[model samples]
Target chain A: MSTSQAPLIPAPGDTRRRPLVVMRSVSKMFSSGTLALSDMSLTVEGGEFVSLLGPSGCGKSTALRIIAGLGDVSTGTIDWPSSRINSKGLPEGDISFVFQEPTLMPWQTVFGNVYLPLKLRGVSKSAAREEIMNTLATVGLADFADAYPRELSGGMKMRVSIARALVTKPKLLLMDEPFAALDEITRQKLNDDVLRLWRETGITVIFVTHSVFESAYLSNRIVVMKARPGRVHADFPLKTSMSRDAHYRTSEDYRQACEKVSNMLIDAIGGEEH
Target chain B: MSDHASAFVPPKTGFFARNRDTLLRTLIPICVVIFLVLLWQFIITVNSIPQYILPGPLAVANSLYNDWGTLSPALWVTTQITMQALALALIGGVGIAIFLVQSKWIETAFYPITVILQVTPIVAIAPLILIYAPTTQVALLICAFLVAFFPILSNMVQGLKSVDHNLLNLYDLYGASRWQTLLYLKLPSSLPYFMTGLRIGGGLALIAAVVAEFAAGSAGAGSGLAFRLLESQYRLNIPRLFAALVLLSLLGVVIFAITSFISWFFLHRWHESSLKREN
Candidate 1:
């Protein structure tokens, strides 16, 4: 009634076991002549929890944004082998993005915010009600469907943001430091919820973060990058502690993984990328 | 819409406590008005000032009652012109603002002209409008519209341009069309700014209409409140003049109240300005 339903996201999905996305020698240069990314190549397997670990100005967020088609790569192309998610109007399994901030429309209710992706895809509010409600329920915000974004607490707002992202049922979910703002406890809870959601959805997630502990805890594979024209310093696979329970966080192996990732990250920050 | 589901209004406290601030706000003004009126009445009675020289509040009220037949029609005329002009101003202002914001070149080309119209006094131009228009009412409406247009246009332009870039990017990331982005995002964001323009424009519209009538100098029949006020002044009917002034003032207040209510209604749900809180 307001306007035509917008295509919420461009979903180009693959049914194969091949890499979902491949970025070969991707580089990004700003208009002001600052190089954000320098020939960083990475391959993302479908349904993998891959963390882009880097400091500020390391272009981790920029890489995620480029994958989501929100930013342009100065050089090289991002290849989606199975689904060609071009930057245009089309209905596919949408690629959903969660920014550092919740990025919920303050004017909309929690329900309306969740309904946005579907609404953009030309789904009417009444038609998309069930999906939005289901997603909200999943995020434990079913009771807050009518509340405004302003009325929500920080963690609750982040949940709402996640709900909005999940409502589209995207094959790939890209998040840039989504829980970097909250307190440590809320962050831990949200991290567990994210892992749960990832297992449940089987969606490919490329999470960007600067924290060594968060990277160690969340991802089985971590891509460590360096600043001053960001380039990937190393990509290593870590042994998962199985479940992300409190016991896992307190486990000796978990501490070892964090320390190992922390040393690699410190080396990335201190060592030069050639 | 599930809006009603979340119509979670905060619980009202006791009548006296809940409205203590509002009550004080209203009570103090009323008390001051009463005291001033009483003091003026005493001064008039003590000095024995004639009604023609300075009609007291009672005399003004009496004039309102006795000359209701003469003044009501004039009051209606003034109201009709003011409202019509205001409505025209709203359409013109909002329309121009949208078009201007669509292209920077268009805004650069036309914005200065609006500023030119705004900076120039209406009084200096009203006589010219009266000379060009087919009727005195048309002239008044044109003047009022000219006066009311700039505020809505400028405020709306600022509002449309002031949208958060990240929100715009969010819409873009979802493949939202330009129209959908504007409708779902920019329009809602601009509503608060538009409300401010409406309130300012409403008062300016009335002022312009009155000034235009004074400039037109048209007598009899379709004469507005300002014309009646002038006529009363010319005839030394001070009580009738005060009565006309009172009606005009009341109309201005009603306009302001309507605009404020509209602002609150649209923004009470989410905006910081209109949201209700304990503090």
Candidate 2:
């Protein structure tokens, strides 16, 4: 938790690496009069494993949706490092969203589900077969390529979903509490698998989760949000080596990092404006 | 290779156990049918009912055999009308459903007309239709079409609307065109609903055909089963009337079976409705 070194929010010259995107005072107000988000700002660098940690009604999903261009922000500007991609990452070059549920087509086979994003882009299924299969192997679901979503266990279904997200090979991947519905064992296992996947693909992941342990474990950076017109409460960077594995999970440092993030979560839920 | 041969051995399955489930499923319905027929025969004989009032099962069977020559042509006519109406309904209904789902304005404007056609009793409209149409066959087809179209339309609409929002967003995120979404997502999603509608419409189509025939029987020399039914009724040919009714009911059963087979053929692999479960 404390290496006695750099601050959580790095300075502009932190590593001579520019953020992939920057959101300054982003806010969202629903038509139903629910101000879901308010003046929340964040900066995500490419290939970083980031988690948006928050409670149930804290608009964590809303933030992720806004990023994926599925929902619009009411105020504030989301700027990309380059103007090639739109503010919401539209025209669909470099973004994939994973919903809280698997969001797979029930009728589609595992291969079919993974092939969806590519298929939508007018790529023939035959042409996309290799990439889809390789992505399936990355998620450890190669054998289930022909299996339907309903035939799969919850974990397997989520694996297929992750494969679909990765099939597109987007620069940024957005996940919204994807493992919240899973059991503890499956979730922990998936956490490890996801980290492996991130390392292998070098895709930036902005995962939203309410679990402090999950956020601490999976992310290099954690952005904490609070409810009641959702806004950023804290943004902390964890000191984790890129090679962290099963051994790192049981270490005192990981426990301390979880403890620190857990306290910030309590503050967010308690309505303390830290 | 034989070091772990146990894993490769096929799991043992008992002959009776495997077939028992299917046997029971098939057997129970057949037994119930036999029991009902026997009970019907028992009641009729016990009440000393005459053949004119209520024919026994044997009498009906005989009537079926004796009247087969006279009845087969009428059966063919009825079958033709039922099939033509069903084909027309399938086309019109599915086409309208596709049209309805294309835009909210179009759906909102024309959906009520479909509802009106569905709710109005086909029997009441049959006479009016007969008066307007050039021939009785066209009127009969229209009646059946009106009766059968709504289920397909409504179910298809529900199917199209039932597409998961996440899947839709995924399509959008990929910049898939609207037509692409419909082709790959919406149409397949609606298949189960369309099948359900087809099954319901199948029986309704037959009923509508028969009902329209009854209405049109007096207007012309309509040789459909309903005309035979009416003629037998007037001449007091009770056995022939029973034979016609039996043929009509059997046609309904056949239509039901065909539609169900169609549904099972399409959905058995993926859909829960048609999946086989372990006992």
Candidate 3:
């Protein structure tokens, strides 16, 4: 299948001008002295789409959590470029996260769930309604503003979660296998949607996934990780010129990219067995 | 032709036929109630029993109508006490449950006291409470509150603690404050359990109020239903006594109905308790 290239329209915002997130040889060891991550280092330029690919118990989630400030690294420092510059040149308004489960507030309506971060940041609903609506529309959930999480389907619920993360418009978005629970067809559809959002919004995303195809399809660069004192295994760049479109899945180059990731994962898993 | 006709024919029994077993199961208790009532009326008529020994259903119904004016006021007094006590119990019980959830030391120290209060017979303590509690009404209220509060507090504390660990972790990831976690997640998650406790507590509160009144009758206030019950027994007004008993039973039923309604109202959409099966 011939790869259909997405029209390389210039993104309205230039995120490449700034270094959005920087991780400096971070390591995490639990109180039990079990090392989850060791000397991990990565830099996410603004608007880049990167994937952390690994088997179960790999520190992909740990890395994502560390970036979000939810988990502290036992032995290293992470410097996120804050949007606002203080007198000391410290960066701010840096990160947001999308958890595996939607983690939506069950009692809240879809609109309310999407509006939470803004509300936390002291933005009134009336003031942020336009941005909330625009984000909801971008995620194809414009009509579900009044529906509660229980009323939504799995895919729809995840869409709301994505919308919530994007509403903040943070420089860096950390997703920990947000679509892993979805069926293959739904997962693929959401992958396209997510890539489209990332392209349009120009937000740097560091997505964690166990699926090799998912990692290859969405990421410009894929960082393969190994388990048991998790460390970087391989970094692969997609040679396929296909952009974030459905045709990318049918492209021969896309299949080769997926196969390459699958081979690396098998070796990673094999090394764990040894 | 006969084979074809058989192929096209539908089964004679419908969906209700499948539920006939459940229908029979439901009718057994109802039939038993009717049979018992009939037997009591028969025994009273055949033995020519004195009204004081065993008043028939008709005699009770008649007395209820005749003394409706006097009995109605006493019933209102009992109902008012039950409602007030239950409201106070709900407030105190949920407050304490939240406190217990917030502090491990408080839970360890005071949980045993709550259990002790629950098991200690109100009958044993009602007289002492009446002596020390300044007013008889306040004593009765306290007794009722004590009886109703523990079940709610215990059930709610368990509910609050049993919130999904993953969901709590998600909140932590989002940097939600403790207050936000309680208001947005914990309280809503604990609601169904709280409703269950409230239902149990409602009936219990009514029982406690009546029992306390029986143990320590009206002090300065004229009299409640319990005093009327004693007065009827002393006067050999068997019918009036029967009327008071019926009123108490009805009051218990009313409390149960209200609590169940509130539970259904809140949980009917998302909860299993209020679900109705078409089949």
For lDDT, the strongest prediction is 1
In DockQ, how does model 1 score against the reference complex?
Answer: 0.55
Candidate 1: tens digits of C-alpha lDDT, residues B167-238 = 787787788888998899988889889999999999999998898888889889989999999999999999
Question: Which tens-of-lDDT digit does each residue in A135-249 have in candidate 2?
Answer: 8898898899999888999999999988888888788888989998999999999999988787666678899998889999888888899998788999888875434578878
Report the C-alpha displacement of residue A135, candidate 1, in angstroms. Answer: 0.6
What CAPRI class is candidate 3?
acceptable
Q: How well is each residue in B95-211 modelled by candidate 3, as lDDT tens digits?
A: 999998888998899899889989999999999999999878788889999999888998899989988775686566556679988987899889989998999999999899889
Two-way DockQ contest, 1 vs 3, winner: 1
Best by DockQ: 2
**Interface RMSD of the predictions, in order shown?**
1.3, 1.1, 2.7
Scanning candidate 2 chain A in windows of ten residues, the lowest lDDT window is A1-10
lDDT tens digits, residue span A1-274, model 1 = 1121111111245342368788999999999999999999999877678899987889898888888787788999888876755545222556888888898888899998899888988998889999999999988999999999998899999999999889888878989999999999999999989977976777778899999999888887899999989889899977653466677899887999999999999898888654
The weakest ten consecutive residues by lDDT in model 2 chain B span: B214-223
The whole-model lDDT of each prediction reads 0.87, 0.85, 0.84
Model 3 residue pairs with clashes: A82-A91, A82-A92, A83-A92
On residues A19-132, what C-alpha lDDT tens digit does candidate 3 reach at each position? 667788999998888999999988777666889999889989988877766657898787766466333233434567788998877657899889887876678889999999
* Fnat values, candidates in order: 0.68, 0.68, 0.19
How far residue A1's Cα lies from its native spot in candidate 1, in Å, is 54
